[model samples]
Target: MSNAYTSPIPIKRTNLGHALASEWTKIKSVRSTVWTLSIFLILVIGIGLLAVANTQSDDYQDVPFTVPAFFGLMLGQICLITLGVLVTSSEYGTGMIRTTFTASPQRHRVLAAKALIFFAIAFVASAGSILLVGLMASGAHSGPEAGDIAWGGTVVKGGLYVSLLGVLALAVGSMLRHSAGAITTMLGVVLVPAILPGFLGIWESTQKLGEKMGDYNAINSLAAIFQIDGPDSSTGSSQLVLLIVITAAAVVGAFALLEKRDV
Candidate 1:
């Protein structure tokens, strides 16, 4: 008679949780994640404090107390973008993607896990830094002239905006599968629209178009959110909606390509 055989390990069906756990592990174990996020914090908090320290209470007369954080975030966002690219593209570079796919055959689940994990990390870091800076600025510069700035809205929207940019960068990285290329494309996505409007304004034929672009570009959107450029109705909601649509499209494209491609 044959002896009955049984395994000691428990067997279970895999789901999104498994993929998320794997992604969480990978993200936390990597050094790039630490370095990029650390720099992001330093740039945002450091420059924000400096801006607040250099100014007097009267400086809040026309703008919100949160305005100083905008200066730091402009530079700090690059670090987030870089981290986003690295999250996806670095695995491809090291040929770790094959193992990932092998372990999690449901490719879209893997992607969703990456996006969710990265977005959460980026959003928390961004919001925390912005809120910290805003509180410090408010303590230093709050006055009647500040006009009851909405600090809560500023922090939440600012975090969402920056986190979406990083998510978009992750989508681009997934498509390009190259860290440097994806980072550069994201930078151009942010900078070119903001910069090109100025050059275009020099030409009479494109002046209106340039003005419109300048009004709706990322910089203007972010500045509007922080109330740094004063109150504006046109820039804030529309720009965020545009970004959401574009990022959704990019994420869909990444998933479609992931299913069709060899790797």
Candidate 2:
């Protein structure tokens, strides 16, 4: 009734939590999340059980006893990366990103929230499957010192690897703004290094560099997480450093583009 009438409801300033909640809802609501994660879990658990059914005496000589679970996880990683790319790229594909930006108006915050949520979900699923596989492997066989193998450390590292890979995929998606392109790029990044090095082996002078590339690649990082030992083996530190550095650079580029480009 008065000229200076107050509002009935209070307005609260938004923060990162709001963004996170939004991303969580979006991720959960998507069919891609369900399909991709379902496939990942099935492959990891099913392959792990198969490995347990065929546990060999020499299997754990150089690798952790739970190493069989990694075979399925290795294949399942592609799906995780696809989901990561789709998280941002699909929005761009269908123009949902405009709505997201309209609601938030803070692009970087949105990206951060998406990355955090995806990382958490991917890590939990990967780690849970790996742990279940490890437990199944340990108990499935009654071999001597079955429970004494280095299971915890390698399993944890594998989870971290998958989580980091998902983050990298998300950053790539934000930069490319195309799901297919970003997914292809992620696949190349993960696989080419392992194969390219072999081609480079023909040149004697380049052989060392090629070997280094293979050892430092994303595929090798999965092996490193398994802590497999041999001349071809690598530790997680080098692979993690390489992948994280590239992902960080991509994320910075994505933020820069967000500011310069119109929705």
In the range 1-263, model 2's lDDT, one tens digit per residue, is 66987899998888999999999999999899999999999998899889888876556555666687788988999989999999999999999999999999988899999998999999999989999888787666637634345678767778878777888899889889999899999999889988899999999999999989988876677888777663245557667767778777877888888788887
| TM-score for candidate 1 | 0.94
The per-residue C-alpha lDDT of model 1 at residue 37 equals 94
Off by over 4 Å in 1: 1-6, 144-146, 232-235
Clashing pairs in 1: none
Each prediction's whole-model lDDT (CA): 0.89, 0.84
Across 1-263, the per-residue lDDT of candidate 1 in tens digits comes to 99898889998999999999999999999999999999999998999999999998878766767778899889888998899899999999999999999998999999999999999999999999999998998987777655564668888888889899999999999999998899999999989989999999999999999988897777888887887766553327777788899999999999999999988
The 10-residue segment of model 2 with minimum total lDDT is: 141-150
The residue pairs that clash in candidate 2, if any, are none
Error of 2 at 81 (Å): 0.6
Candidate 2 Cα outliers beyond 4 Å, as residue runs: 145-147, 230-234
